[model samples]
Target: MDIWKNIIIDKHFWAFYYYCKRLGDKIWFQKLDDNRANLYLIKNGK
Candidate 1:
C-alpha cells in the first residue's frame, strides 16, 4: 500500500530534525537566543 501525505512546516524545523537524526542519541539542546542553539552530547548518563 502507498499513501501520500502533504503538510506545511518550517524549513528550519526540518533542518534541526535531520540534524538530530544524524546525532542518533544522547543530545542536549539549549536555546541561547533567537536564531541560535547549542547541541551537546550526554556522557555516562550525566
Candidate 2:
C-alpha cells in the first residue's frame, strides 16, 4: 500500500539492473547509499 511497494509492483514501473565488473563493490555501495537515505528518513521520523 505504501509508495515504495506500489512502485515495485506497478506495471508501469521498470527496474534497471546494471552489470558491474565487481558485484561485491556495487552491492556495498548500493547498501551504503540505501542505509544513509534510510537513516535520514528515520531521523526525520518519516
Candidate 2 clash pair list: none
How well does each candidate superpose onto the true structure, as a TM-score? 0.38, 0.14
lDDT per residue for candidate 1 within 2-45, as digits (tens), equals 21122224565456556766776755544233555644333222
Each candidate's clash count = 0, 0
Best by lDDT: 1
lDDT of 2 at 3: 33
Candidate 1 residue 19 Cα shift, in angstroms, is 0.2
lDDT string, candidate 2, 2-43, tens digits: 434322232222222222222323321121232342211101
Clashing pairs in 1: none
Candidate 2 deviant stretches above 4 angstroms: 9-46
RMSD in angstroms between candidate 2 and the native structure over all alpha carbons: 11.6
Instruction: Give the alpha-carbon lDDT of every model.
Output: 0.45, 0.25
